[model samples]
Target: MAAMLFGGLLASNPAEAATAVSSVTVTSVNSGDITASVEGKSELAEFGEAVRDEAPELAARSVSDLAVDYRVLKVDMKQVRAQFAPGVACVDGDGNSRAEDVIVAPRNAENIRYELSGDAQRDPNYDPAKQGNRCDPDLFWDEGASPEVDDDPAASAPVRPYTEKYASACFARKSQWKDIYGIYLEVSYNDSCWSDYVTKYDGNSSWNYYSVKAPSSCHIARGTYLTSCGHGVERNAAKGPVVKWDDWAPAADSNGDCRDKGISVSVGPLSVGGSYTHCEKQNIYKYAEDGKMSSYWKGKVTGTRATQHQVSVRVAQNAGRPRWTHWINSDACVCYK
Candidate 1:
């Protein structure tokens, strides 16, 4: 019975509907016999039968003696885009050539200014002696020029600047439950369908573009069982997105279309046996940007993030016995630039 219930809960088709037992009314017959009037779908009927078979003593208990708990799980996913401008030559107050700022326009329309110039004095990450002339790419139009010309007529020439744009895709899913006399018992499992981020580009230039593929899908499954002590138990499991990046190949891939990363996740089991509640959670954040404007002229960038939470609880029956309940909730998001 437990195996069958687990299989049903973990079914791949999250769209399937399964109703829980809502209420159970007890009545006394003229013969002084107690009868339970159960109200719910097949799942609830099976639950009642399981309880009776495991612990016949519970058959005489009234609705007030049996406690049921309900919890809802929700999942969501979304995508966003970021933009960057072309490189430009810059000079310090002393008239010496310096690394130009890499202007980035995040999704919030706010600009994040930074420099890739391998100058120790400017960026602590760079070693000027080892990484010679790292400022040429940001200071000169022709990246191949040797001797690093400090002043060139073409450096001041008019050039196209990067444009700003936005693109996104979103999806959401929630667990279903049955209401039993104001209490809830989760019965059905649900999951978000596969969603994709359509490619989007700036109208001014095809070189400037943004998008994300291989989006994310969320899953939630739950089942009930009879404990050794003849008590009821509910278990839940769920997973969110884990993004993976492709190998970097500049010449073969230009628009960053090969950048779509895959997704994966691993969730441990959670069990609560008493009146206490327990929860486990995980959060992830990742960001990737073009290394050089010349190679990835599109200035594409991306951010992938996700969060997950699993909760479990055991309700105390009228006789002080424990009845377990558990659920999992998660969400994933991808930001493109």
Candidate 2:
């Protein structure tokens, strides 16, 4: 499950480095039992405030770009039980209390560790002799660009100045830590979706401009794709090498429609199909107003286009991209060269 734990406090503008502490309330529960408390000396409140005011862009980051850090402290439950339900008391089916599960001083440890790293090493063996890592959710907050706003009141988008920085800070955090063996909690974060709204859309611009509206959707799938086929602009689930790849935007006309025009794509690892090939027939279609596919494409190629990369059909061409047959489950759809 994803958890979005926003700090309830707000700080001054975060254009500069300033630190302050606020009382942080942490509530933990298992099954239906909840434990809420205001811990001492936690930077959570300060971190939460900085996240809201300073790092608007960080709020737009996907769940993949988030990490949680902090420590978990334990105390003897036996002392408080006499006044409460001392020890691990189990409620019987008839609602009767059983004291067998209760323990007074059952092993107490100070802190635990956790991380979200991909290699799985983030989860370490717990040792009371060692200081385990804690979950500090504030570390994942980035105070870079401001949020993007659309006509929609809730469309708050974050700007990523650099991709690597976003990935390193959130996407690849250590998963877990080892403090006192045999106890751990999996790290989690909320998935922030796109908030920018589309105000105006121009389907027919000399430059094919769509009024350049605000961003409204989170980039669901982004990264490089390599296939024996070339990339098509149609949102096809099966046409491209990877399925459901829909994050690509229209390529600027200035780039010369590098791929859609059959020009070569950046040649890189030959992981899919070694070497380049001409797209004997290349096209990019769209789902139209009438809910029908667009016409076939008219274009040309010159450079050595690589396999399975997104390409755009230029507006200058009389015809647009081909009807995405993959939409109809037709194997006739072509993706690679």
- Provide backbone clash counts, one per model: 6, 38
- List of clashing residue pairs for candidate 1: 22-180, 80-336, 81-336, 82-336, 82-337, 301-337
Where does model 1 exceed 4 Å of error? 1-163, 179-183, 186-209, 212-337
Give all candidates' CA lDDT scores: 0.19, 0.20
Residue 55's C-alpha lDDT in candidate 2? 38
Off by over 4 Å in 2: 1-36, 40-46, 49-176, 181-195, 203-337
Residue-level error in angstroms, candidate 2, position 18: 50
The numbered model that scores best in TM-score is 2
Task: Provide the global lDDT of candidate 2 against the true structure.
Answer: 0.20
Q: Give the TM-score of candidate 1.
A: 0.18
lDDT of 1 by residue, 272-291 (tens): 11111111211121213211
True lDDT of residue 55, candidate 1: 32
